[model samples]
Target: MRLTVRTNIAMRALMTCAVNPGKIVRKAEIAEATGASEAHLGVVINQLAQTGFIETIRGRNGGIRLRLPPEEISVGRVFRTFEANTPFAECFSARDNHCPIAPVCKLRNSLDTALEAFYASLDRVTLSDLTCNNAGLERLLSLEPVC
Candidate 1:
Protein backbone atom coordinates (compact mmCIF):
# COMPACT_ATOMS: atom_id res chain seq x y z
CA MET A 1 0.00 0.00 0.00
CA ARG A 2 1.11 3.52 -0.71
CA LEU A 3 1.83 5.74 2.26
CA THR A 4 1.43 9.50 2.37
CA VAL A 5 4.52 11.62 1.86
CA ARG A 6 4.12 12.96 5.38
CA THR A 7 4.23 9.44 6.84
CA ASN A 8 7.27 8.55 4.75
CA ILE A 9 9.16 11.68 5.76
CA ALA A 10 8.17 11.38 9.39
CA MET A 11 9.37 7.77 9.49
CA ARG A 12 12.68 8.80 7.98
CA ALA A 13 13.12 11.64 10.43
CA LEU A 14 12.24 9.41 13.35
CA MET A 15 14.66 6.73 12.17
CA THR A 16 17.33 9.33 11.70
CA CYS A 17 16.80 10.51 15.24
CA ALA A 18 16.89 6.89 16.37
CA VAL A 19 20.22 6.44 14.66
CA ASN A 20 21.68 9.53 16.31
CA PRO A 21 20.04 8.77 19.66
CA GLY A 22 20.75 11.58 22.17
CA LYS A 23 22.07 13.96 19.55
CA ILE A 24 19.54 16.61 18.61
CA VAL A 25 19.03 16.95 14.87
CA ARG A 26 17.69 20.17 13.43
CA LYS A 27 14.57 20.12 11.26
CA ALA A 28 16.29 22.11 8.55
CA GLU A 29 19.05 19.54 8.51
CA ILE A 30 16.55 16.71 8.42
CA ALA A 31 14.64 18.30 5.57
CA GLU A 32 17.83 18.89 3.63
CA ALA A 33 19.04 15.41 4.36
CA THR A 34 15.79 13.72 3.43
CA GLY A 35 15.13 15.92 0.43
CA ALA A 36 11.83 16.93 1.94
CA SER A 37 10.52 20.47 2.23
CA GLU A 38 11.11 22.16 5.58
CA ALA A 39 7.60 23.58 5.42
CA HIS A 40 6.12 20.09 5.01
CA LEU A 41 8.41 18.57 7.63
CA GLY A 42 7.24 21.17 10.16
CA VAL A 43 3.74 19.75 10.02
CA VAL A 44 4.99 16.13 10.25
CA ILE A 45 7.29 17.04 13.12
CA ASN A 46 4.41 18.62 14.99
CA GLN A 47 2.32 15.48 14.53
CA LEU A 48 5.19 13.22 15.60
CA ALA A 49 5.78 15.32 18.71
CA GLN A 50 2.09 15.25 19.53
CA THR A 51 2.09 11.48 19.16
CA GLY A 52 5.06 11.21 21.57
CA PHE A 53 7.49 9.89 18.98
CA ILE A 54 9.88 12.80 19.16
CA GLU A 55 10.55 15.85 21.30
CA THR A 56 11.25 19.34 20.05
CA ILE A 57 13.69 21.87 21.46
CA ARG A 58 13.76 25.54 20.62
CA GLY A 59 16.40 28.32 20.34
CA ARG A 60 19.99 28.10 19.25
CA ASN A 61 21.58 24.63 19.31
CA GLY A 62 18.07 23.27 19.53
CA GLY A 63 16.54 20.51 17.45
CA ILE A 64 14.52 17.30 17.70
CA ARG A 65 15.24 13.99 19.43
CA LEU A 66 13.42 10.73 19.89
CA ARG A 67 11.49 10.66 23.14
CA LEU A 68 11.87 6.91 23.61
CA PRO A 69 14.73 4.54 23.00
CA PRO A 70 14.97 3.22 19.44
CA GLU A 71 14.47 -0.38 20.53
CA GLU A 72 11.30 0.59 22.37
CA ILE A 73 9.80 2.36 19.38
CA SER A 74 7.98 -0.34 17.47
CA VAL A 75 7.72 -0.03 13.72
CA GLY A 76 4.08 -1.04 13.91
CA ARG A 77 3.36 1.90 16.20
CA VAL A 78 5.01 4.30 13.81
CA PHE A 79 3.15 2.88 10.82
CA ARG A 80 -0.19 3.03 12.59
CA THR A 81 0.32 6.57 13.89
CA PHE A 82 1.64 8.12 10.71
CA GLU A 83 -0.05 5.99 8.07
CA ALA A 84 -3.60 6.20 9.31
CA ASN A 85 -6.52 4.81 7.30
CA THR A 86 -4.33 2.38 5.43
CA PRO A 87 -6.84 -0.18 4.16
CA PHE A 88 -5.54 -2.62 1.62
CA ALA A 89 -8.82 -2.52 -0.29
CA GLU A 90 -12.16 -0.74 -0.33
CA CYS A 91 -13.83 -3.71 1.32
CA PHE A 92 -11.45 -3.52 4.24
CA SER A 93 -12.67 -0.09 5.35
CA ALA A 94 -15.26 0.13 8.10
CA ARG A 95 -16.91 3.13 6.46
CA ASP A 96 -17.06 1.62 3.01
CA ASN A 97 -20.73 0.79 3.29
CA HIS A 98 -21.18 1.17 -0.43
CA CYS A 99 -19.40 -2.08 -1.23
CA PRO A 100 -22.06 -4.68 -2.06
CA ILE A 101 -19.85 -7.58 -0.98
CA ALA A 102 -19.09 -6.10 2.41
CA PRO A 103 -21.31 -8.53 4.27
CA VAL A 104 -19.74 -11.76 2.99
CA CYS A 105 -16.45 -10.81 1.44
CA LYS A 106 -13.91 -13.48 2.27
CA LEU A 107 -11.30 -11.50 0.38
CA ARG A 108 -11.52 -8.72 2.93
CA ASN A 109 -10.85 -11.18 5.73
CA SER A 110 -7.89 -12.64 3.90
CA LEU A 111 -6.57 -9.20 3.18
CA ASP A 112 -6.94 -8.33 6.82
CA THR A 113 -4.89 -11.35 7.76
CA ALA A 114 -2.22 -10.40 5.26
CA LEU A 115 -2.15 -6.86 6.55
CA GLU A 116 -1.88 -8.11 10.09
CA ALA A 117 1.03 -10.29 9.10
CA PHE A 118 2.69 -7.32 7.47
CA TYR A 119 2.29 -5.24 10.60
CA ALA A 120 3.42 -8.11 12.82
CA SER A 121 6.58 -8.44 10.76
CA LEU A 122 7.28 -4.78 11.21
CA ASP A 123 6.47 -5.00 14.90
CA ARG A 124 9.26 -7.49 15.34
CA VAL A 125 11.76 -4.83 14.28
CA THR A 126 12.74 -1.48 15.76
CA LEU A 127 14.46 1.63 14.47
CA SER A 128 17.72 0.31 15.89
CA ASP A 129 17.45 -2.71 13.65
CA LEU A 130 17.29 -0.39 10.68
CA THR A 131 20.35 1.53 11.82
CA CYS A 132 22.74 -1.26 12.65
CA ASN A 133 25.40 0.02 10.29
CA ASN A 134 26.33 3.32 11.89
CA ALA A 135 29.52 3.85 9.96
CA GLY A 136 27.92 2.95 6.65
CA LEU A 137 24.99 5.21 7.38
CA GLU A 138 27.28 8.13 8.23
CA ARG A 139 29.24 7.64 5.04
CA LEU A 140 26.08 7.33 2.98
CA LEU A 141 24.52 10.37 4.62
CA SER A 142 27.72 12.31 4.06
CA LEU A 143 27.81 11.45 0.38
CA GLU A 144 24.10 11.75 -0.39
CA PRO A 145 23.23 14.38 2.19
CA VAL A 146 19.68 13.15 1.72
CA CYS A 147 19.37 9.70 3.25
Candidate 2:
Protein backbone atom coordinates (compact mmCIF):
# COMPACT_ATOMS: atom_id res chain seq x y z
CA MET A 1 0.00 0.00 0.00
CA ARG A 2 1.29 3.40 -0.97
CA LEU A 3 1.50 5.66 2.04
CA THR A 4 0.21 9.21 1.66
CA VAL A 5 2.39 12.30 1.84
CA ARG A 6 0.86 13.01 5.22
CA THR A 7 1.99 9.66 6.59
CA ASN A 8 5.49 10.13 5.26
CA ILE A 9 5.80 13.62 6.64
CA ALA A 10 4.14 12.74 9.89
CA MET A 11 6.71 10.01 10.47
CA ARG A 12 9.46 12.41 9.57
CA ALA A 13 8.08 15.01 11.95
CA LEU A 14 7.83 12.47 14.71
CA MET A 15 11.34 11.25 14.04
CA THR A 16 12.56 14.80 14.15
CA CYS A 17 11.02 15.20 17.56
CA ALA A 18 12.19 11.80 18.70
CA VAL A 19 15.78 12.47 17.79
CA ASN A 20 15.66 15.70 19.67
CA PRO A 21 13.68 14.60 22.66
CA GLY A 22 13.48 17.11 25.55
CA LYS A 23 13.99 19.89 23.03
CA ILE A 24 11.14 21.53 21.17
CA VAL A 25 11.40 21.44 17.38
CA ARG A 26 10.11 24.30 15.30
CA LYS A 27 7.86 23.62 12.33
CA ALA A 28 10.15 25.64 10.09
CA GLU A 29 13.06 23.39 11.01
CA ILE A 30 11.03 20.28 10.39
CA ALA A 31 9.86 21.73 7.07
CA GLU A 32 13.42 22.55 6.12
CA ALA A 33 14.70 19.11 7.07
CA THR A 34 11.91 17.06 5.58
CA GLY A 35 11.31 19.30 2.55
CA ALA A 36 7.62 19.65 3.48
CA SER A 37 5.69 22.84 2.94
CA GLU A 38 4.48 24.82 5.90
CA ALA A 39 0.89 24.16 4.85
CA HIS A 40 1.42 20.40 4.84
CA LEU A 41 3.42 20.50 8.07
CA GLY A 42 0.70 22.56 9.71
CA VAL A 43 -1.99 19.99 8.91
CA VAL A 44 0.18 17.00 9.88
CA ILE A 45 1.36 18.64 13.07
CA ASN A 46 -2.18 19.47 14.11
CA GLN A 47 -3.32 15.92 13.47
CA LEU A 48 -0.37 14.47 15.40
CA ALA A 49 -0.97 16.82 18.30
CA GLN A 50 -4.70 16.12 18.34
CA THR A 51 -4.00 12.40 18.50
CA GLY A 52 -1.83 12.95 21.61
CA PHE A 53 1.39 11.68 20.09
CA ILE A 54 3.05 15.05 20.22
CA GLU A 55 2.55 18.23 22.21
CA THR A 56 2.70 21.76 20.80
CA ILE A 57 3.54 25.03 22.44
CA ARG A 58 2.72 28.43 20.97
CA GLY A 59 4.25 31.95 20.95
CA ARG A 60 7.94 32.87 20.87
CA ASN A 61 8.97 29.67 22.60
CA GLY A 62 6.60 27.78 20.32
CA GLY A 63 7.54 24.33 19.07
CA ILE A 64 6.61 20.66 19.25
CA ARG A 65 7.72 17.65 21.29
CA LEU A 66 6.57 14.13 21.77
CA ARG A 67 3.98 13.78 24.54
CA LEU A 68 4.61 10.09 25.01
CA PRO A 69 8.00 8.44 25.12
CA PRO A 70 9.31 7.46 21.70
CA GLU A 71 9.19 3.77 22.55
CA GLU A 72 5.51 4.08 23.44
CA ILE A 73 4.57 5.63 20.09
CA SER A 74 3.81 2.82 17.68
CA VAL A 75 4.42 3.36 13.99
CA GLY A 76 1.48 1.16 13.05
CA ARG A 77 -0.84 3.27 15.17
CA VAL A 78 0.34 6.45 13.49
CA PHE A 79 -0.05 4.97 10.01
CA ARG A 80 -3.51 3.67 10.82
CA THR A 81 -4.61 6.99 12.23
CA PHE A 82 -3.84 8.86 9.00
CA GLU A 83 -4.97 6.05 6.73
CA ALA A 84 -8.11 4.84 8.49
CA ASN A 85 -10.50 6.29 5.92
CA THR A 86 -8.21 5.59 2.98
CA PRO A 87 -9.16 2.59 0.84
CA PHE A 88 -6.64 0.30 -0.80
CA ALA A 89 -8.77 -0.03 -3.93
CA GLU A 90 -12.18 0.73 -5.39
CA CYS A 91 -13.51 -2.53 -3.95
CA PHE A 92 -12.36 -1.42 -0.56
CA SER A 93 -14.51 1.66 -0.57
CA ALA A 94 -18.19 1.04 0.16
CA ARG A 95 -19.46 4.30 -1.28
CA ASP A 96 -17.45 4.32 -4.51
CA ASN A 97 -17.12 0.61 -5.25
CA HIS A 98 -18.18 0.04 -8.87
CA CYS A 99 -16.41 -3.24 -9.43
CA PRO A 100 -18.74 -5.97 -10.63
CA ILE A 101 -16.97 -8.85 -8.84
CA ALA A 102 -16.68 -7.11 -5.52
CA PRO A 103 -18.38 -10.06 -3.83
CA VAL A 104 -15.84 -12.67 -4.95
CA CYS A 105 -12.76 -10.52 -5.33
CA LYS A 106 -9.90 -12.56 -3.96
CA LEU A 107 -7.64 -9.66 -4.80
CA ARG A 108 -9.22 -7.59 -2.06
CA ASN A 109 -8.54 -10.27 0.52
CA SER A 110 -4.99 -10.65 -0.64
CA LEU A 111 -4.52 -6.93 -0.48
CA ASP A 112 -6.02 -6.88 2.98
CA THR A 113 -3.59 -9.56 4.11
CA ALA A 114 -0.68 -7.69 2.63
CA LEU A 115 -1.82 -4.47 4.25
CA GLU A 116 -2.15 -6.16 7.60
CA ALA A 117 1.33 -7.58 7.31
CA PHE A 118 2.63 -4.15 6.47
CA TYR A 119 1.11 -2.64 9.58
CA ALA A 120 2.22 -5.58 11.66
CA SER A 121 5.77 -5.05 10.51
CA LEU A 122 5.53 -1.40 11.39
CA ASP A 123 3.95 -2.25 14.71
CA ARG A 124 7.23 -3.79 15.83
CA VAL A 125 9.03 -0.51 15.39
CA THR A 126 8.60 2.73 17.29
CA LEU A 127 9.79 6.32 16.98
CA SER A 128 12.80 5.42 19.11
CA ASP A 129 13.55 2.39 17.01
CA LEU A 130 13.53 4.51 13.88
CA THR A 131 16.10 6.88 15.27
CA CYS A 132 18.05 4.65 17.59
CA ASN A 133 21.81 4.65 17.01
CA ASN A 134 21.33 6.19 13.58
CA ALA A 135 23.75 9.04 13.44
CA GLY A 136 22.65 9.92 9.91
CA LEU A 137 19.02 10.39 10.93
CA GLU A 138 19.99 12.30 14.01
CA ARG A 139 22.27 14.47 11.92
CA LEU A 140 19.66 15.04 9.25
CA LEU A 141 16.91 15.90 11.70
CA SER A 142 18.96 17.94 14.12
CA LEU A 143 19.11 21.72 13.89
CA GLU A 144 21.98 21.76 16.35
CA PRO A 145 25.50 20.59 15.67
CA VAL A 146 25.99 16.86 16.04
CA CYS A 147 28.08 16.25 19.12
Candidate 3:
Protein backbone atom coordinates (compact mmCIF):
# COMPACT_ATOMS: atom_id res chain seq x y z
CA MET A 1 0.00 0.00 0.00
CA ARG A 2 2.86 2.35 -0.69
CA LEU A 3 2.03 5.66 -2.33
CA THR A 4 3.76 6.75 -5.54
CA VAL A 5 6.38 9.49 -5.45
CA ARG A 6 4.11 11.62 -7.59
CA THR A 7 1.25 11.27 -5.11
CA ASN A 8 3.59 12.24 -2.30
CA ILE A 9 4.72 15.29 -4.27
CA ALA A 10 1.14 16.32 -4.99
CA MET A 11 0.31 16.24 -1.29
CA ARG A 12 3.42 18.25 -0.44
CA ALA A 13 2.60 20.83 -3.10
CA LEU A 14 -0.94 21.12 -1.82
CA MET A 15 0.27 21.51 1.74
CA THR A 16 2.69 24.21 0.61
CA CYS A 17 -0.22 26.12 -0.89
CA ALA A 18 -2.42 25.46 2.13
CA VAL A 19 0.11 26.93 4.53
CA ASN A 20 0.55 29.98 2.39
CA PRO A 21 -3.06 30.68 1.49
CA GLY A 22 -3.87 33.71 -0.70
CA LYS A 23 -0.36 33.87 -2.13
CA ILE A 24 0.83 32.59 -5.45
CA VAL A 25 3.56 29.98 -4.94
CA ARG A 26 6.11 29.51 -7.65
CA LYS A 27 6.70 26.07 -9.13
CA ALA A 28 10.39 26.44 -8.38
CA GLU A 29 9.60 27.11 -4.74
CA ILE A 30 7.37 24.09 -4.53
CA ALA A 31 10.03 21.94 -6.16
CA GLU A 32 12.58 23.22 -3.73
CA ALA A 33 10.40 22.66 -0.70
CA THR A 34 9.14 19.27 -1.71
CA GLY A 35 12.57 18.07 -2.96
CA ALA A 36 11.01 16.96 -6.23
CA SER A 37 12.54 17.54 -9.60
CA GLU A 38 11.31 20.63 -11.42
CA ALA A 39 10.19 18.60 -14.42
CA HIS A 40 8.25 16.16 -12.26
CA LEU A 41 6.74 18.90 -10.13
CA GLY A 42 5.63 20.66 -13.31
CA VAL A 43 3.59 17.64 -14.35
CA VAL A 44 2.08 17.07 -10.91
CA ILE A 45 1.27 20.76 -10.54
CA ASN A 46 -0.53 20.77 -13.88
CA GLN A 47 -2.49 17.69 -12.83
CA LEU A 48 -3.40 19.33 -9.54
CA ALA A 49 -4.63 22.43 -11.37
CA GLN A 50 -6.68 20.39 -13.83
CA THR A 51 -8.27 18.47 -10.96
CA GLY A 52 -9.61 21.76 -9.48
CA PHE A 53 -7.39 21.63 -6.44
CA ILE A 54 -5.19 24.55 -7.40
CA GLU A 55 -5.29 27.54 -9.71
CA THR A 56 -2.43 28.44 -12.04
CA ILE A 57 -1.73 31.84 -13.48
CA ARG A 58 0.67 31.86 -16.42
CA GLY A 59 2.67 35.02 -17.06
CA ARG A 60 5.66 36.95 -15.85
CA ASN A 61 4.01 37.35 -12.48
CA GLY A 62 2.18 34.02 -12.59
CA GLY A 63 2.30 31.23 -10.05
CA ILE A 64 -0.06 28.84 -8.20
CA ARG A 65 -2.59 29.08 -5.37
CA LEU A 66 -5.23 26.93 -3.78
CA ARG A 67 -8.50 27.02 -5.78
CA LEU A 68 -10.55 26.12 -2.72
CA PRO A 69 -10.14 26.70 0.98
CA PRO A 70 -7.85 24.29 2.81
CA GLU A 71 -10.77 22.97 4.80
CA GLU A 72 -12.61 22.08 1.59
CA ILE A 73 -9.84 19.92 0.12
CA SER A 74 -10.03 16.39 1.45
CA VAL A 75 -6.79 14.42 1.66
CA GLY A 76 -8.63 11.29 0.63
CA ARG A 77 -10.08 12.99 -2.42
CA VAL A 78 -6.67 14.19 -3.53
CA PHE A 79 -5.25 10.72 -2.98
CA ARG A 80 -8.02 9.16 -5.06
CA THR A 81 -7.50 11.66 -7.88
CA PHE A 82 -3.89 10.62 -8.30
CA GLU A 83 -4.18 7.01 -7.22
CA ALA A 84 -7.19 5.94 -9.30
CA ASN A 85 -5.04 3.80 -11.56
CA THR A 86 -2.62 2.59 -8.92
CA PRO A 87 -3.01 -1.07 -7.95
CA PHE A 88 -2.36 -1.72 -4.31
CA ALA A 89 -1.26 -5.32 -4.92
CA GLU A 90 -0.61 -7.49 -7.96
CA CYS A 91 -3.86 -9.29 -7.19
CA PHE A 92 -5.73 -6.03 -7.36
CA SER A 93 -5.04 -5.68 -11.07
CA ALA A 94 -6.68 -8.21 -13.31
CA ARG A 95 -4.34 -7.54 -16.20
CA ASP A 96 -1.25 -7.90 -14.02
CA ASN A 97 -2.31 -10.65 -11.69
CA HIS A 98 -0.90 -14.12 -12.44
CA CYS A 99 -1.68 -15.70 -9.10
CA PRO A 100 -3.66 -18.91 -9.63
CA ILE A 101 -5.69 -18.50 -6.46
CA ALA A 102 -6.78 -14.92 -7.13
CA PRO A 103 -10.38 -15.98 -7.68
CA VAL A 104 -10.67 -17.38 -4.17
CA CYS A 105 -7.93 -15.48 -2.40
CA LYS A 106 -8.88 -14.27 1.07
CA LEU A 107 -5.75 -12.10 1.11
CA ARG A 108 -7.17 -9.91 -1.64
CA ASN A 109 -10.30 -9.28 0.38
CA SER A 110 -8.28 -8.48 3.46
CA LEU A 111 -6.06 -6.10 1.52
CA ASP A 112 -9.15 -4.43 0.08
CA THR A 113 -10.53 -3.89 3.55
CA ALA A 114 -7.20 -2.46 4.70
CA LEU A 115 -7.05 -0.12 1.74
CA GLU A 116 -10.57 1.10 2.43
CA ALA A 117 -9.67 1.72 6.03
CA PHE A 118 -6.63 3.70 4.90
CA TYR A 119 -8.79 5.94 2.75
CA ALA A 120 -11.48 6.18 5.42
CA SER A 121 -8.96 7.55 7.87
CA LEU A 122 -7.67 10.00 5.31
CA ASP A 123 -11.23 11.06 4.55
CA ARG A 124 -11.39 12.48 8.04
CA VAL A 125 -8.54 14.88 7.33
CA THR A 126 -8.42 18.00 5.15
CA LEU A 127 -5.52 20.18 4.05
CA SER A 128 -6.37 22.44 6.96
CA ASP A 129 -6.13 19.54 9.34
CA LEU A 130 -2.61 18.84 8.11
CA THR A 131 -1.46 22.43 8.48
CA CYS A 132 -3.29 23.73 11.52
CA ASN A 133 -1.18 25.29 14.27
CA ASN A 134 1.97 23.69 12.96
CA ALA A 135 4.60 26.35 13.41
CA GLY A 136 7.45 23.97 12.60
CA LEU A 137 5.98 23.19 9.21
CA GLU A 138 5.64 26.88 8.51
CA ARG A 139 9.26 27.40 9.45
CA LEU A 140 10.43 24.43 7.39
CA LEU A 141 8.55 25.71 4.38
CA SER A 142 9.70 29.27 5.09
CA LEU A 143 6.14 30.61 5.17
CA GLU A 144 5.44 33.86 6.89
CA PRO A 145 3.41 33.81 10.08
CA VAL A 146 -0.29 33.90 9.35
CA CYS A 147 -1.73 37.02 10.91
Put down candidate 2 lDDT per residue, 1-147, tens digits, no spaces.
589999999999999998887899999999999899889999999999999999999999899999999999999999999998899899989999999999987999989999999999989988888899999998888878755
10 residues in a row with least lDDT, candidate 1:
138-147
- Summing lDDT over every window of 10 consecutive residues in candidate 3, give the lowest-scoring window: 138-147
Cα-based TM-score, every candidate: 0.84, 0.94, 0.93
Off by over 4 Å in 1: 142-147
lDDT at 6 for candidate 2?
93
Clash-forming residue pairs, model 3: none
> lDDT winner among the candidates?
2
**lDDT per residue as tens, model 3, 53-136:** 999999998999999999999999999889978988889887999889988889988889988889889988999998889988
> For residues 15-102, could you state the per-residue lDDT of candidate 1 as single tens digits?
6786666688999878877788999899999999999989999999899999988888888878878766665677756786579878
Clashing pairs in 2: none
lDDT of 3 at 133: 93
Candidate 2: C-alpha lDDT = 0.92
Q: Give the TM-score of candidate 2.
A: 0.94
Candidate 2 regions off by >4 Å?
A: none
| Model 1 pairs in collision | 33-146
In candidate 1, how many Å is residue 13 off? 0.1
Each model's lDDT comes to: 0.80, 0.92, 0.89
* Candidate numbers sorted by lDDT from highest down: 2, 3, 1
Ranking by TM-score: 2, 3, 1
